[model samples]
Target: MSTEVAQNTLSSLLEAVQPPNGGRNIHDPATGELVARAPEHGTEELDAAVAAARAAQAAWAARSHGERSEFLNRAADAIEASAEALAELLSREQGKPLNGPNARFEVGACASWLRATAALDLQPEVLVDDATSHAELHYRPLGVIGAIGPWNWPMMISVWQLAPSLRMGNTVVMKPSEYTPLSVLALAAVINTELPDGVLTVVSGGREVGERLAAHPGIDKVMFTGSTATGKAIIRSSADTVKRLTLELGGNDAGIVLEDADPRAIAEDLFWGAFINTGQTCAALKRLYVPESIYDEVCDALVEVARLMPMGNGLDENNVLGPLQNKAQFDIVARLVDEARAAGARVLIGGNPVDDQPGYFYPTTLVADIANDNSLVVEEQFGPALPIIRYSTLDDAIAMANGLDVGLGASVWSSDPAQARQVAARIQAGSVWINKHGAIDPRVPFGGTKQSGYGLEFGVDGLKALGAPQVIS
Candidate 1:
């Protein structure tokens, strides 16, 4: 379909799906335009979506893995075909740059993940071949999965849940965050055209709808990606139904720069690693721990490169960075940066928002010589502001990095790969990187180790997370 046709179709569909109570308005973070409306679906809508999923689950599960995978592949193909239009919508709604490794990149990731997961194979395990009785562990689909996606990297993350769940033969009723619901809606609208009516659905809303979906007994599994606090609430609600859950929650990821590493050599990589998607990424490097010997140099290297990276509206292809996606997030980032500055943290670069900007556009901020206990260093400032702290010893650096309750991801930068791996092994996180941070593969499992979240996504573990393993003798 043409871009104009797709836009009109999406608008009509949005109008059709809008809740009876005139749902919440979704605004473009760059221009503050009323981009779309997220239907404030509540208990009734949640139940209806889950019921549809349940009705479709049987036929979907009855299909062979190959058949299910084919559907996923078709969806991926559809996504790639309409990528430009989708990426444009994503940039307008998500506030990420459309080109130059931003929204377009993310939309590409969604297609890649869907196609990859579709092509992936998982065989039933034979456990006791030599014994008197033979045993086989078969992965069977759960009835219906309730997937709640966060706003940051909305399209890719939703596919991270939907692709695997559908590949495992489970139908899904998804709830994309109200902040950026249009992307998911547009994506699902395209993909669902190829699949059965109830196989996949998107219900847009805030907390109430999500609560109902998690608590409802119709859903066999709840796969949520969002805040730690919200994850806890889902846990409490899902407890009553004893629903299986896979939560990918918050992260205050830290990256350590060793004295042996070249700050200038890795400066650009480090900058993108932390500030990709304007640092709204859950796995982005929020805190940088630099050795006292090279702390100043590392700070200077980051600021020098960060200043050159353009920040503007996502539609402008020249802009590598875009505005914060929402006002709440912008305020949070502002408050944290201001508090850190008040606490004697040195602002090495852009510390303030673009004065009187149309939207929530904060500058690429770098806090130097900040104490580990400072809020900017301690909390997850999910924006472009990064805090670089000085550490005297490796032990202290590791301690400071591991001190936080959130441990989604961490990285070590050093000249020696082996040495970096040794230190990486000491850090408590789900994924650790050497030289780079947040470069994930579709075949590798990605998850968190502590309060960040539980259950894995991607690879064999991800496939199994959507199903029940039944051992047959």
Candidate 2:
């Protein structure tokens, strides 16, 4: 379809969405342009969507896995075909770089996830094969899933929620975060066109809509990806209905660079680790612990790479990093960094919003010599500023790393892979990497520990999270 026609189609879908919390303008954070107006839908609309999903779910569930896989494959094909348009929409709405690996990576991930989920098959397992008795384990679909997605990687994260639910034969009524709902609505339209009505629905909204979805009796499961505070609220709201929940909450991930690590060799990876997607990622390396022996060297190396990386509006293809996804996030980054600086932290590279920029464009920042109690070191900044903490002993570093209540992901960098792996085992996180941080695969299970979240979201284990186990004899 022509760009104008495609845009009109997206506009029609946005108009049709029933935002319950009333209406709000969706702006491109990178350019501060009004892109779309979204309604924060309320309980009535949520109920209607859930009921429709309930009606359509059984038929969807009854379809053979192969048949359902076909639908998912078709949706994947559609996404891949529209990768550019979707990436543009994502960049405009979510504020990630359109050309550089930001928006395109997320859009491509959606298509990849659908295709990967379709490729998976959950076969029945035979537990007993005696002469006279036989037992087999079967995976049965949940009727409907209520998905509440976050804004950091809107399109990709929704796919993380929806693809598995669809593969396991469940319908979904999803609410994208209020700040960036346009691309999600557009994505839902693409998927819904290939599948049966009500199989997947996107209703963009804020807190009220999320609460309604979590509490709705018709929703068999609620899979949420956002803050820990919100996840706790979802648990409380869903308790009365006994709804199944899978929450991917906030994370204050820590990365430890070993004393023996080559500062120059890991500099680029380290830069991307902390600032990928402008550091809005839940599993982004928010805190870095380095031995005092090489602390300044590591800082200098990171600055050299980060200073050279392109930072600008997402519409500019050459820019690698765009603005924070929203103003609140940008402010959070600013406040945390400012607080750290006031507390005697040294800014090695940057700690300011781009001057004269209309967007929420905070520069990639690195702070050093911050105390342990500094909020920039303690809390999940979820933005572009990263605090580098120096530790004289590895024991002290491990203690500080494992001391946090939020444990989503952690990484250990060392030239000796064995030592790194051993150290990684001590980090209290759902996933730990020997050298890389936040690198995930569709075949590997990914989630968080402590209050980060409960339940997993990828791999065979994740697919099974959307279904119930039945044994027949």
Candidate 3:
């Protein structure tokens, strides 16, 4: 489609579009009460959105990198100005504590990413030259990027994809998870005001919308974050177009505590890593392998920490532990807990759902004596459930940690700096933390390996993912 035609198509699409079919009625998973109704987008809407994006892509790509960056910076400013309202909406929709440091941290990261992308030099430029010839290379935008973001960290992940693509001069058509579509829409509102009409658009719905978006002929690339199963399906569907893809899929990340580590420190990190967001994080430390020398000590300390975590509505200042985002997540947590108990594992701390709660709420649970083969240890429970596995040898622990199909993120804890560094190097995950877990910076690239999917999502590497290298001689 011609650039003018595409622009008109996109304008018409946005003007006539209504929020997805599932109009507001979204509930606060924490309180089981109506939080807001989410707008749903169906296949037809998704098609129109993609058409609009494709139409705008060429014109967007024609702009100078500096021009695109300016737009990104403005969008960042808009997001920061609306941080409070966005945080509240996020908490209500996704069940994270609205007032928690994590919520604020997300807002800061969003703005930081936008500003960072703006400052980056992503245009084609010159390289070393010989006497006979001159060599030059330029970064070119990938047209019509299709970003399918997850519910857990909705706005942040969307920005992770959107910022780099937009800065690199690609128009984006995003499909936010139906579970947390409002926050994404709020973000889109900010972008729409700060950017060209078709620069960024959000289409919200269930599987059909995602499927349509992934397979849309106009989309040149697809970036998805969700379960490994869904990632595989997206890959399969994109085969026809051979679209460039970046998939940040499921992860059953492990935290290894060496015998030389301090049990107290390891326990603290483990608590926050595993239980934060009620363990809805994909990179959260789901399986922990503690050296036999510190196993009991670590377990005891973890139990104590888990007990102190306050569970209630996410909007409440005192509530550290919030409800699962939906009933499906609640059921998954409950099933994992039950399965662990039946398989001879002991609950070292909180287990089972909290009574007298309307929403989907699961307790911060620590399960001990969980075998590697057990469901809790092997599968991606994706809940507030942590299973502690004991290891007598460092080699055994490392082997066990890397045994899974997932290679997303891992953490190694040791008092000895050398030991921690060495162990971190050996882990198979894409990002490794030494004595820390779930720590992310916009300046650092993040993603996974193996079934966790491929490609980086932040930093210079992430921005490069949205562009192609063109050589001129």
Per-residue CA lDDT of model 2 for 92-186, tens digit only, reads 88888976559989888898899998888678999999999999998899889999988999999999999999989999999998888888888
Better of 1 and 2 by lDDT: 1
Q: How does candidate 2 score on lDDT?
A: 0.87
User: Candidate 3: where are CA atoms >4 Å away?
Assistant: 1-24, 123-128
- Cα TM-score of candidate 2: 0.95
Which is superior by TM-score, 1 or 3? 1
Per-residue CA lDDT of candidate 1, range 1-473, in tens?
A: 22222223434545544555766888889999987666676678778888899999999999998998878877777777778778888899999998777988997898899889987879989988974879999999988999999998889999999999999989999999888888888888878867888999888777888988899889999999999999999999999999999999999999999889998999998998899999999999999999999888888899999989999999898999999998899999999999999999899998877677799999999988888999888788999999998999999999999999989999999999999999999999999999999989999999998999999999988998888999998
Winner on lDDT between 2 and 3 is 2
- How many Å off is the CA of 427 in candidate 3? 1.3
Lowest-lDDT window of 10 residues in candidate 2?
1-10
TM-scores for all candidates: the values are 0.96, 0.95, 0.93
Ranking by lDDT: 1, 2, 3
Runs in model 1 with CA error above 4 Å?
A: 1-22
lDDT of 3 by residue, 286-311 (tens): 89998888799999999988888888
Task: Name the candidate, 1 or 2, with the larger TM-score value.
Answer: 1
